[model samples]
Target: MKKLLTFSKQAVLIAVPISLVISIYVNSLVTILFLLVFLPDLIKNFKKNNFSKNRKVFFVFSAFVLVYLIGIAIDILYGTANFRKSERLLPFILFPLFLLFSDALTVFEDKKTPLKIFGIFVLCFNLFLLVNLFTQTVVEYNDNSLSNKRWKKSNIKILENSKERYALFPVSEIHIADVASRPDLLMERSFKFSRDTLITRSVYVKSNDDVWLLLRQFDGNRHEGAWFHPKTARVGFVQKNITADIQKLENGWSRISVTNRVAKKANRERLQITFVDENKQYDVKGNVEYQLYVGGTQLEIGDSPSDYMPLQHRNFLEGFDRTTILNVVEGHPTYYSLFILISVLIIILFFRSGYVQFLGLVLNLVMLVLLGSKAAILTFFILLFLVLCFNFKNRDSRLKLLYVVIPLSIIAILSFSNTLNRFNQSLSSVTEKNDVVYLSTDKRIEMWKSVIDLPLLNLVLGNGNRHGYELLESSTALTLNSHNQYLEAVLCSGFIGLILLLFFVVGIFFVDFSARNNQLLILFVVLVGFNLFFENLLNRQWGIVFVAFFLSYIYKLGEVNE
Candidate 1:
C-alpha cells in the first residue's frame, strides 16, 4: 500500500504539468478539479515531523490559515455567499492537507530524489513555454505591424477556431439626429447609430484635407451620446437624386463639392447634402449643412437647409457591453511563474553550485521586475536605490551611473510623452465625443478603498477560496475584487489566514537569505507582495496556484542544510 501510494504521488508529480498543458485546450474546470482533489495530500506534505521540527515556520503557517478562515466566517455572516465563497472554502481544508503530506514526506523519505525530479519537470516545462512564446511572438510580429493597422495570423487563427462569428470595424462612427428645434442647427440632440449605418458616408481625411468648411459642420452635432467605441471618423459625400447632375466623385478622400442651380421660382424645397453610410442612413440638418461646404462651393449649391431639425429619427445603439478574460489553462501564465521560481530554488538547494545560485538570483529579480506585483513595479527603483545605499555590493560605481541614468530617463520620457499624449487624445477625441457619461473613475476608487478596510481578525482565518468579489463589493464603488492583497486575505480567510500568509511571505524571505537556497526568492516575494496592492491576489486559479507553488519552493529552499 505504501509503495502504491508513493507511486501515485510520483505519477501525480509528473502528470500535473502535462494535465495543465492539455487543459490549455480541453477544459479548465476539469484541471482545476483535479488540483483540488490532490490538494489535501499536497498540504499534508508540509506537516513534516509534526511541525515540531520548525515550530516558528509552522506557527506562521497556522496563523496564516487561521486568519484566512476567520475572514471566510465574516463574509458568511455578511451575506456574501456566492461562487467565490465556495472557492474561499477550498484552501481551508486543502492547505492543511498540503502541510500534513509535506511533513510526512519530509520525515519519512529522502527529499533529494523527489525535489530533483520536480526541478527537472519545471525546467522542461519552462523550456516549452519559452519556446512557444518566442515562436508565437515571431510569427505574430512578421504578420502584423507594430502600428496595429494590420492583422496577425495568430489572431486570425483564434478567430477561426472560435465558436462565434464577428466582424472587426464593421460599424460606422458618425451619428447625427434628424430633428432640430430651430434653424441655427447647432443644438441638435445626438443619438446612437448602428455600425451598419455608419460606413456609407465615413471617410479618412488626411492632414492636408480642406478643414475650413468641415470644421464648422463638425461643431453642430459631432458626438451626442456616450462615445465608448474608439474608431476613426472623417468626412465623405453621399449621392442623392437632386444632385445627380453633379459628377459622382467617390475616391475615398475626394473633396466633395456641390453645385445646385435651382431657380428662385422653384417652390421652396430646401437644398441639402445627405450622407448615407453603412452604419446609418440620414439627411443632414439645417444651416449646419451649408456650413459644411467649401467657400465657392457654398454659392454653387442651393438654398440653406431649414431650422426645424426633426426629433423623429433617432437610433439607440449601444457599444459592445460585456467582456470576459479568456483563460488558456485553469489559471494564467503568472500562475506557472511561481512554480518556475520554486524550481530554481530547488536546483540551488540540491545542486549547491554557486553558479546556479547566482543564476537563480538573477532570474528571480528579472521575473519580479517584470511580473512580481503592481506594488513592486511602482517601488522597485526606490527599493533598489535604498539597498544600494545599504547592503548591496558594488555600490559606488552603480550608484553614480544610476543617478545619471535616472534623471536622464525621466527627462527623456517626459519630453517624448507629449507626442504620445496627443496621439492618444486624438483618438479619444474622435471616439468619446459622443459620450455624455462614463464609468471608469468611480469604480476603480471604490474597489481600492474597500480593500483598505479589511480587518485584522479576517487576516488569520481565511474567508474562503472564492467569494472575494462578493465580500468586497459593498465597500467598493464598483463590482470588483479587493485589489489589495491584505484585504483579499481577510476577505478570503480571517486574521488566521493573514497570519498564514505573512508566514508564507516571511518564510520565503528568511529561507531566501538564511539558507541561501536561492536569492531569487526575495525578488519573487517582493513581486507577490506588490501584486497584492492592485489586484485580487488569490481569488483566481492563477493567483492561487502561483502562491502555492512559490511557497512550496521557499519551504524547500529553507529546508536545505549547510
Candidate 2:
C-alpha cells in the first residue's frame, strides 16, 4: 500500500506541472481541469496527514481569503454583486487549488532547478507568443492564416468591440478653436470662396460600393477626403454617408470646420443619427449615444450627468492584445515576457549561488518596471535613494541613480512642454482640454478625497476590491482606485487584511534584507509599488500576472527529494 501510495504521488506530481504549464499558456478551461486533476491527492493527504507544521502559512493565507469573502458577503447583502466586483473573489476559488498544487510540488521535487526552469520556460513561452505578434508575417493575422483563424474564435468579441469604421476624408487632428474668424455662410455641402465665391456645390451622395470624395472651391482648387465606411449592414453600428456638403468656401477652402465638444454640460441623453432622403423619410438609423460626428471628426460620447450605464465599465483590455503586438513591433516596452522569464531565471541562478540580497533587489526592480505602475516606481525609487544614500556601498550607484532620475525627468519635461499637451489634444481631439498637462497628480488628489468620508473600518476593509467605485460613487472624480497600492490595501482588506498583506510584503523585504540582498528586494519593491499607482493591479491581467509571478517566487516551497 505504501509503494502504491508513493507511485500515486509520483505520477500525479509529474503531471501537475505539465498540466499547469499547459493550462496557463494554452486554454482557459485547462486551469479548472488542472486544478481538479490533483483532488484525489489532496483528499488522501488531508485524510492521512496532520497539517500542523505548515499551518501558519495556510492559516494566514486562509484568513486573508476569508475576510475578503465576508466583505463580499456584505456587498451582496447590499444588493451590489457586480461582475467586476464578484470576479475579485475569484482567488477564493483559486487558492485551495493552488495549495493542493503547492503540496504536490513540495512532495515530489528534489531539486530547486525545476522551479527555476519552469520560470524560464514561462518567460520563453510568453516571449514566443509576443514575438509571433511582432513579426505580423505570421498568417494568423491574415484572414487566410490557419493559426490566425483559430484565434478568431478567441477574439470574436474583442474584434467586434474594438471595431472602428474607416473614414473617406483624412481627418485633421484638432489643434484649437479659432473663435476669431466669422462663420462663412454657404448652402449645405456648398463651398463659398471669400464673401461671394461659390467654389463647389455640396453634393449628397450614397453608394453600395466604396468611393472617395473630393471637394473643389469656386477658385477651382481641390481638397480630397476618403469615405471610410461605404457599405452598411443593419447588424452592426457602422458609419454611413448620405450627403457631403462643402456649403461655404472662402478663397480655396471652406470656412467651416468640424469641432467636437468635450465639456458639454448638458444632462446626457442617448441620441441617434438618422439619414433622410429628399423625401424627408428616415433612410438609415444609428445610435449616436456612443458616437458623434463633429464636422469630419469622430468623438466618443461618454457618460454625462443624466445618461449613464452603471455597469458599462470601461474595457481597457478592448484592444490590449493587438496594441501590445503593435508595441512589441515598435520596440516600445523593449523587454517582452521572454525577457522577464529569462531575467527571473538568471535571478534564480543567483539564489543558488547564495547572492540572495542582490537577487531580491533585482527582482523588485524588474517586477516594478514590468507592472508599468508609475506611482509604485516613484515610491520605490524614493525609498531606494533614501536608503542607498544612508547605507550600502557607493560602488554601483550609477544604475540606481539613473533609475531614480529618468522617470522623474520625463515627468518634469512633459509637464513643462506645451508640445506634449498639443499632441494629446490632437490624438484625443478633446477640444475642451487645450493641452495635455500632467493630469495624474490631479486624479490622485480626487481619488483620495472620494474615500475620505468612509469610516475607518470601511476604509480598512476597502469596501471590497473595486468597491472603491461604489464607495466613491458620489465623487465628481468619475472613478475610484486609490491608484496607490498601500491605499488599495487599506481599502480592499479591512485593517486586518491590510496588516496581513503588509506582513506578506514586509516578509518579502525582510527575507531579502535579512539575506543581505538589497538588489532583488528593491527590484520587486519598485515594480509593484510603481504599478499600483496608475493601475488597480489586481483588476488588470498584467497586474495579475505580476502578482502571480511575485507570489510564486516569494512563496516557493523548499524542494524535496523523491
Candidate 3:
C-alpha cells in the first residue's frame, strides 16, 4: 500500500513539470490528485495548524485561485452548477494543496525535488519550442517558395508596376512582418533622380512571354529614359549616357537594371513603365512580373560602396530562416514573446553565461524581436537594463564594457529592421479607429477606458467569470478582452479579489525579505507584474500554468532558503 502511494506520488509529480506545455487535463488532474491525496489531510490541517512561511505563501496562492472557486460557488447557488469554466483553473488551488500535503506528510527529504524536476522540464520544453520552430520554418519556407505568390499575405497589397505585367513575381514572405515596409508602402512603381547624379532602376522579373520594356520620364514634355528588350538585351535611349544590366536569379527569375548616366541632363523625376512590344510580340495586358529596386547617386536612393558591403537591401538578417519561418506554438505572438522574455529571465537568474548562456540569451532576444509583441519587447529591454545595472558596481571593467555595448549594439542593428517601425507605431497616439494599426499601446489606452466605465456593481463584486466576460465584451466591443490582467482579474473576482491577487504576488517580496534574495525576487515580481499589465495571462491555460508554477516554485525556492 505504501509502495502504491509512492508510485502514484511520483506520477503526479511528473505531471506537474509537463503541465505547463501540454493539455489542460494534466493541469486540472493536479486537483483530482489533491482530492484523492490530501482532502482528509486538508480538513485536519484546517482544524489545527500553524502558518509557516511556506504555508502562508501557499494560502496567498490558493486565495487567488479560490476567488474564482468562490465565484463559481456564487455562480452555482444562483443557477445550475458549472465548474466547467473554472475547472481549468484547478491547478492553482490544487498544486499548492499538493505542496502543502507533501510538506505535511514529509514526502521527500528534499521538498524542492518536484520543483527542481519542473525546472529541468521547463528547459527541455523551451529547447523543444526552438527546435519545433526550426522545423516549422523549413516547411513554411518551402510553402512560401513553391506557392510562387506575387505579393505577401500581409496588408493585402497588390502588384503596382506595369513594366513586367505577365510574369509572376517571386513568392512573398508571409512569415513575419519582416517585409512590412516594402509592400505596405504607398510607393509608386517608379524611381526619382537628382540633377547631378546617376539614377538606377533594377527590376526582378519572371516572364510569361517575349516583351520589350520602355522606361520613360515625362517631366514637362522632356522625355528622357531608356527602352530595352528583356529577351534580346537590346536597348534604345531617348537621351545619351544611359546604361542597363541584367543578372539571373534563382528559379527562372532575372534582375534587370536600367541606369541613366547623365541625370543632370535628364532631371528624371517621374518614371513611366510601358512595354514597347505590347501588341507586336506580346499582348497589351502586360508580359512580365517583377519586384523593382532603384539605387545609384540619386537622392531618392544611394548605391553601396562595394558589392560585399552593399546597401541595406532587407530587414535585419532577412536572408535568415529564423525571421521568416517561425510562427509561435503558443496562443498569440504576444504570449510566445512573453514566454521568450521569461526564458531569458530564467537564464539570467539561474544559469551562468560563458558562451552557451550568452547564445541562449541572443536566441531569446532574436525570438523576442521576431515575435514582435511591443510590450514584451519593451519589457525585455527594460529588464535587461535594470538587471544589468542592479549589479553594475560589482562587475569588472571588461564585463562593464560588454554590458554597455550589448544593448546599444542590439538596438543599432534592430533599428534597421521593421522592429523600429513597430516601436514607432506603438508610440504613436491613436485618436480614431482608422489609426489603430495594431491595437497598439494607444488602443490599450482605449481599452482601459472601458475598465473605468465598468458598472459599479461589477466593479465591486464581479458578475462571475462567464457573466463578467460577457459584460466586459459589451463594454469593450472594440476588442476581445480588456487586454490587462489586473482589469480582467477585477472583472472576474471583483475589486476585493484584485486586492487578494495583489497581496498574493506582493507577499513574495516580504516572504524572504533580505539582501541575498531581494535582487532576483525583485526581477521575478516586477517582470511578472509588468507583463500582467499588458496581457490577460491569468485567463489562459499557458499563462495560468506559467504564473502558478513559476511564481509558487520560485517563491518557495526563496522561502526554503530562508
lDDT of 2 by residue, 1-562 (tens): 8667655555543433333434434323443454565566667777766755334444433333454565565566557655444454454345433552345454443534444555545454445544564354333222211122222221111122222222332211111122222111111111111222111122222233221222211111122211222223111121222113222322222212111232212111111222222122222222211111112211123222222121111332111222234232232221232234334433433344434424434444443343333344345446555455544565543335435444654554354322233234334433344232224444555566555666876875556544546666555435556765556656655676567655544444443333234444344545554455445555543344345433433343321221
Q: What is the TM-score of each candidate against the true structure?
A: 0.45, 0.49, 0.57
Off by over 4 Å in 1: 1-8, 14-65, 83-134, 142-446, 450-476, 489-531, 549-562
lDDT of 3: 0.53
- Model 2 misplaced stretches (Cα beyond 4 Å): 1-27, 76-93, 96-103, 106-115, 118-323, 326-441, 453-468, 485-497, 503-534, 540-553, 558-562
lDDT of each: 0.39, 0.37, 0.53
TM-score top scorer: 3
Predicted model with the maximum lDDT = 3
- The whole-model C-alpha lDDT of candidate 1 against the native structure comes to 0.39
Instruction: Give the per-residue lDDT of model 1 (tens digit) for 453-483.
Output: 6564443444564555555655543555555
lDDT-wise, the better of 2 and 3 is 3
**Clash count in backbone of candidate 3:** 4
Task: Score candidate 2 by TM-score against the native.
Answer: 0.49
Question: Where does candidate 2 have its weakest 10-residue lDDT segment?
Answer: 183-192
